[model samples]
Target: MSTTTIDRYRFETGIYRPPSEGGSASLLLRYTRNCPWNHCTFCSMYKTEKFQLRPVADIKSDIDAMAAVVDDLKAISMDIGQNGTITRDAAVSLIGKVPALNYHEGFAMLFHWLLSGARNAFLQDANSLIMKTGDLVDALHYLRSTFPSINRVTTYARSRTLVQKSPEELTAIRKAGLDRLHLGLETGDNELLKKIKKGVTAKGHIKGGKKAMVAGFQVSEYWMPGLGGREMTGVHAAHTARVLNEINPDYIRSRPFRTIPGTPLHAQVNRGEVQMLRPHEQLLELKNMIGALDVTSRVCFDHAMNNWRHPRSGLLFTHDYEGYKFPEEKQKVLELIEAGLNAGNPVSGAG
Candidate 1:
């Protein structure tokens, strides 16, 4: 391959995405640079970085560069006995030829994504909807056209941004091929919401989530279980359940509160101001939330933070991405929580 062709394989990627995207499973397509809302007390992600929206032209160029990587990989495959199949030998051969790929940030991610059937992708950094509607739509169109193998394109979004966007603009972006939104609804209690500086209220969470649903985006709402601690746990669970019931999103994920070291919440925890929940207490809180919940959404304890012991299995909850389907599996989930509560305190708290 020519030097120009080798250079064509360069692209930009950011550091974070949802766990369900799988390690090296989805291409890290950067639409924005960092977290636009970096004020969350509990968050340490993108704290030292500033947020920036890349130009649509630059974004499209990144897409083209990514496509060049795939094309070259396929070419290498064709040259080998694999006949265009993306294989280990082809990737090894490409790396051998272009040794610079060893130092490329997005190289391993892109190659593994192709190996995984290239069916899914996650837009990187924090929020993508903060971009101008026309620009977002243009980029989405270019992306959909460029990688037709990618059916699911998900992104992290602030609830406030969704509320600020016009209905028509959201519909336009949705129609342009953006599929799902992962919203961080840490807690629905007004006090905790304000304490975290989440930048959106319980009322606002419902409105933004409903708007996204109306605009044809599959919504995945995440809530932190012990965010309020013992003082506010009851209200937190009840109100969070109420909000989720109102939104009835496609997914309701549990991200148990883990105080990150450089974060404001960690300082609070150290100061004895914000107490973390014990394992059993966390389970009881989950029961309260699950009991109050009335939605058709999938309730997931997909993160390691949901650490508690089960009598039979090692973990209290299954770390399945598509968690227990609500309404049908609600009873089963409650029973599991009871089991965890009854089972001894040999378990550990992730937070």
Candidate 2:
């Protein structure tokens, strides 16, 4: 299946999202076409596409199309409930001949959104907030007005763009209805930040993150455990914890490094310029970071990539890793990491 540009909608969408959004019933609304700063060495999602902001008119039209689809689906449900079964022919007749509207990935997403109660939404593709503040506010307002049931709306944001935004601008955005901002703060170490081409310094991360929080938006800061490799692991963990302490974001999510093919980081690994940490080492690094954290933010090891092996059975990470509230469960999280370390598992390098 094509990863970008579903046909049912009048607009285009690029494939990318935070891991926390997975398995949620949120609708994926395409506000921007691709990553504005598609230069991060670890990301491969938007490398093939040029960044473009969808015109506000075009975005509104897409919102209208989505609303139409929802209305049609509701009508179909009433018909199906009364008739007992929905025939393919009947569905086509009711929903029209649009392939995406009737029988494609767009329809599948629409079905899931409806089934999931349409309480949340995620803006696409990479950083939606990079658009002009007035335009973004207008688009967000349109989105909420169109879907009154949506309780939360989220988007990825770059620290560079966000730091450039004034507190007033961020407040305007928050009042416009965006509830959450997910930042890929790969590491707080300046050297590691430069190595990863994250385009923001440690100060920039803290400033932008604090601005978002002050604007009343729940912020999720992403930390990569092994991004610094073996050489800078100590500083990576310590400085990341320090920054998180300063920002005190709503969520601290762990995205343990996984080298993907066709990225600069992968090239670095191949050339022996960087060495990935073994699973055990990564867990120990996480333990150290957790131990250093002094914030009220919730720490999450929920991503599949962060779950390492125990050498005995199942994952070293527990099921409650998603919302391991900090300070309260810090010791428990440390113990879990220690358990993984003591599991006698052979060191395995991540891809």
Model-by-model lDDT, in order?
Answer: 0.89, 0.81
lDDT of 1 by residue, 1-351 (tens): 644456778789888888787686677899999988899999999999999999999999999999988888889999987899888899899888888888888889898888888988898879999999999999999998999999899999988999999999999999999999999998888889999999899999999999999999999999998898888899999999999999999999999887889899999999999888888788889899999999999999887778788978898889989999989999999999999888877275654
Clashing pairs in 1: none
> What residue runs in model 2 are displaced by over 4 Å at the alpha carbon?
1-11, 80-105, 311-313, 319-322, 346-351
What lDDT is reached at residue 197 by model 2?
85
**Model 2: per-residue lDDT, tens digit, 247-297?**
999999888788999999999999999888888788888888999999998
Q: Specify the poorest-scoring 10-residue window by lDDT in model 2.
A: 1-10
Backbone clashes (count) for model 2:
1
Candidate No. with top lDDT:
1
